[model samples]
Target chain A: MPNQEKIRVNQLTKVFLKHKERVMALEDINLSIKDGEFICILGPSGCGKTTLLRILAGLEKSSSGEHQINNSGTDRPLQSMVFQEQGVIPWMTVEENVSLGLRMRHAPKKLINERTKTYLRKVGLTPYAKLYPKELSGGMKQRVSIARAFANDPEILLMDEPFAALDEQNKFILQEELLSIWEETKKTVIFITHSIDEAILLSDRIFLMSSQPGTIKEEVKIDLPRPRQMTQVRSDPNTAEIFLKIWKHLQTEVQESRTKNER
Target chain B: MEELKKAVEVEKEDLRRRQRSKKFKQILTISSPLFMLVIWEFLSQTAIIDPRFFPPPTTILQTLFSMSASGELFEHVRISLIRILFGFLLGVIPAITLGLIMGMYSSVRHFFSPLIMALMPIPTLAMLPIILIIFGIGEFSKMVTIAASVFFPVVINTVAGVMNIDKVYSDVAKNYGANPKDFFMKIALPGAMPVMMEGIQMGQAIALLTIVAAEMIGANSGIGYVIWMNYKAFLIAEMFVGLILISFFGYLFSLLLRGLQSKLIPWK
Candidate 1:
C-alpha cells in the first residue's frame, strides 16, 4: 500500500478577472503529496505556481474543487508561507519577527522565547537577533523569513521563490541550510520557483506546470541521493538530462501561451 | 593596471574631499543662526533701527531674566501648556480613531469626505467670535479653538497613513490568522506610525499657534496676552520677550517631537 497522503487536491481551479478580462489562472489541477516529501513547482511567470501555493496555504480561495490536508479533515492545515520578497516586517527586530506567529497563536512566552532562540541559532541569526529588518542584508532577511516559518513548527512549509533575490553564494548556502532543516523536521515542503536547476537540485519530485490556465504537465522524480550538494548535482549528467526533458515540455507550453496572448 | 591604480587614488581623494565638505557644512549649520544674532545685536546697538520699536537681543534677554525671576513667565507657560495638552488630546484621539476607520473602509470615507472638505478650509480662528459668544472668553473657548485648529491635519494625515500602508503586510497578517486586534496593533499601527507621528507633530505645532492667536483676541493669561498687554504699554523689550518665548517654545516642542519620533520608529 502507498504511504499515507499528507495533502490531496481534486480538480482545483482558480479564476480571476484582471482589467475586465476573465482569466483562469489554474485549471483541473489534481495532485497528492506524500508525507515528508519536498516538492518543487516549476513554471514560467504568471503560470499560477504562486497561485497554486497560495491555495495550498489557504491564503487564496479556489474557484472550484476540494483540497484536503493529511486526509484528516476539511479544516485548514497548519502551514506557513515564505513570500518571494522576504516579507519580514521592517519595524520588528529579528527575534520579534520570528516570534510573530507564536505571538499570534498566543503561545506561552517561555515556549515562544525557546523556539525563537532555537530557530535563530539554526538560521545563524542569533548574533543579529536584536537588529531590525532594515539593518539586515537581503540574504539575512530571507534567513529570518525561513526561521520564522520554522519557528511556527507547521506541518507544511510553502516557499514562493524564497531565495529569488539573493546572490548565488547566499542562495546556495540557504539551500543547504533549508535541506538540513527539512531533514531534521521532515516537514512536507511545497517550494515554488521558476529555476529548473534549483528545482532539480532541491526537490525530491518536480511538478512542471504549463502557462495560463496552468496544469501540471509533468512530475519528474529526481532519484538523487539525499544530502546532495549543488556542485555534485551540477556535475552529474543526469541532472542536465532531466533539466532538458522538463524544458522541452515547458518550451511548447510557453510558445502556446505567447501565441494565445498575441491574439 | 596603472590606470586602475590612479582611478582608485582619485576616488579615495574624492571621498576625503566629500567628508571634509560635510564636516564644514555641519559646522556652518550650527553657527549660522548665532552669527545672524550677533549681526542683529550690532545693528540694533548702532541705532540702525529704533530701539524703542525693535529692542536689541540684550534687552529682550534682560526682560526674559526678570520675568523668570518673578515666576510670571512660568505661570503663563504652564497655563498655555495645559490648554494645549487638553485641546490636543480632544482633537487628536478622536481624529486618529475615526480617520483609521475611514481609511479601512471606503464607504465610510466616501460618506464623510464631502463634509470634511466643506469644513476643513473654514479657518478655525474665524470662528473665534462665535465661539467666544457661546463659550465666553474663558478657557473653554480657547481650548475649543485650539482643538478645532489641530483636528484637520491630524485626521487627514492619519487617513493618508492608513491608506499608504502596503497591502502585502495586511495580507500576510491575515494569512497568519491574526484577529482584528492583532492586525491593528502589529501590522496596521506600526506600519502607519511614521506618518501618524508626523501628523501628531503637525497637530501639536498648529495647536500652539491656535492657542496664541486665540489668546490675542481676548484672554487674561497666555504669552499672547502678555505680548498684547506690553505692546499697549509700549514695553518694547517685554513684547520682544514674549515673541522670543513663543519661538523658543515652538522650537523646543519640535525638538521633543523629533526625539520621540526617532525613539518610536528607529527603523525609519
Candidate 2:
C-alpha cells in the first residue's frame, strides 16, 4: 500500500499589503508530506518560509489556496508548534509548562505527570522541573519548549527555527535530543529553518525556497539511513554533496535579497 | 559524618554573614529618617526657623501621642482606613472585570477607551465640588472621590497588562486546543499578573493621594479633617501630627503591596 498522505498544501499564496503597496510573500506553493516524514522548508531571510509555517499552524490565513492536515487516528491532537522565540510560558514552572497541553486537553493528573516527567527527562530537564523559565538559560528554555511540544504528543510537530537562536554547542546538543525524541515518536514534523546543515541533518526532505515572491525552488530528499549520528553523517561524503546543492541554491537567494536591500 | 558536619558549619557561617549585612542595611535605612528628624528638631529648638509654622518632630510626636491617648486619633484613623478600604474595593473589582473584558474584546476597548481617556486626565480632586453637590458633603462623597481616583489607573494599567502579553503565548494556547475558559484562566490572567499587580499598586497610591483632598473638602472626622481643622486654628503641631499619620499610612500600604507582589510573582 502507498504511504499515507499526512499533509497537503495546494497553490498556497500570501500577500501582505502595506499602505497601497501589495507585496507577495509566498506564491503558488505546493507540497505533499507523508505520514511520519520530517520535512524542512529551508530559505534565506524574507523568503516567507515562516509565513508558510504560520499558515500551516493556522496562526495566519493564506490569501489564496488551501492545505489540510490528516487526522492521525483519534488519540492525538492535529499539530503543535515550537516557536522561533522562547516559547515556554515564563510564569509557569518547567513541569507546569510541560504539562500545559495535557492540562488543556483535560487529561488525567496521573497521565499528565507521567508524560511531563518523560519529556522533561528526555530533554535533561528533570532536575529543573520546579524552576520558572526566567531561571533557565536560553538553551535550557528551548529545551523546555521542546519538552512541552513533545509532551503534548501531537500528531504533527510544527517547529519554526526553534533552535535558530542557540550557540553552536547548544544547537548540536538540542538537535541530538530532538532526534532521539523524534526517533521514538516518529511524528510528522514540518520544520522551517534558514540553515542548510540543520535542514540536511534533521529532515527527510528539504524544500528549498526562493525569495522575492518566495516559492519552492527544489525539493532535495536526504536519503541517509535510519538511526543517523550527527558526527557520522558529517563524515559521510554524501552529506557534503547534499549540503553543496542546498547551499548553492540558498547562496544565490541570500545574495539576491542583499543586493535588493542595497537598492 | 564529619564532612556533613563541616558543611553544616560552613552553611551556618554563611547565613550569619548574610543576616549581619541585612541588619546593617536596615540600620542605614532607618538613619535617614532619624537624621531628618534631628535636623528639624535642631532648627526649631534654636528658633532658626519659625516653630509656629514648622513645629519640630518632637512636638508633632507629642501631639500625636496625646490625641491617641484620648481616643480621638484612633477614631479618625479607623474612619479614614474604612473609607479607603471600601473605596479601593469599589474601584478595583469593576476595573479588573472591565479591564479583562476590554482586553479580550477590541470593540469594547474602542468604546471605553475614548471615555476613559477623557476622564483620566481630570484629577479626581477636581471633581470634589460636583461630588459634594451631588452627595451633599457626606462620607459618601469622600468615598466616591477615592474610588474615582483609583478607578482610572487600575483600569488603564489592567487593560495594558492584558494587551501587552506576547502573541506567542496566545498562539501556543490555541495550538494546544485551549478553549476560551482555559485561554483566560491558564494564559491571560497569569500572563497579565505582573502588570496588573503594578496597576493595583498605582491605584492604591492615587487613592491615598485623593483621600486627604476628599476628607479636607467635607467631612467632620478623619485624619484629613484633623489637618484642615488644625490648619484653620493655627495649631501647626497638630497639623504635623496629621501629616505624619498620612505618611505612615502610605508607607504601610506600599510595604504590604510590595510583599504581596513578591509572593505572587516570584518568577519576576
For every candidate in turn, the CA RMSD to the true structure comes to 3.1, 4.0
Query: Chain A TM-score of model 1 versus the true structure?
Result: 0.95
DockQ, each predicted model: 0.53, 0.61
**Which segments of candidate 1 are over 4 A away from where they belong?**
A71-77, B1-20, B129-137
Evaluated at residue B65, the lDDT of candidate 2 is 89
Q: What is the interface RMSD of each candidate, in Å?
A: 1.3, 0.9
In model 2, which regions exceed 4 Å deviation? A258-263, B1-28, B132-138
Candidate 1 achieves a global lDDT of 0.87
Model 1, residue A76: displacement in angstroms? 9.9
Clashing pairs in 2: none
Q: What share of the true interface contacts does each candidate keep?
A: 0.47, 0.72
Candidate 2 lDDT, A98-211, residue by residue in tens: 998999999999999999999999989999999988999989999888888899988789999998999999998888888989988888999999888888889999999999
Give the whole-model CA lDDT for all candidates, comma-separated: 0.87, 0.89
Per-residue lDDT of model 2, residues B221-246, tens digit only: 89899999999999999998989999
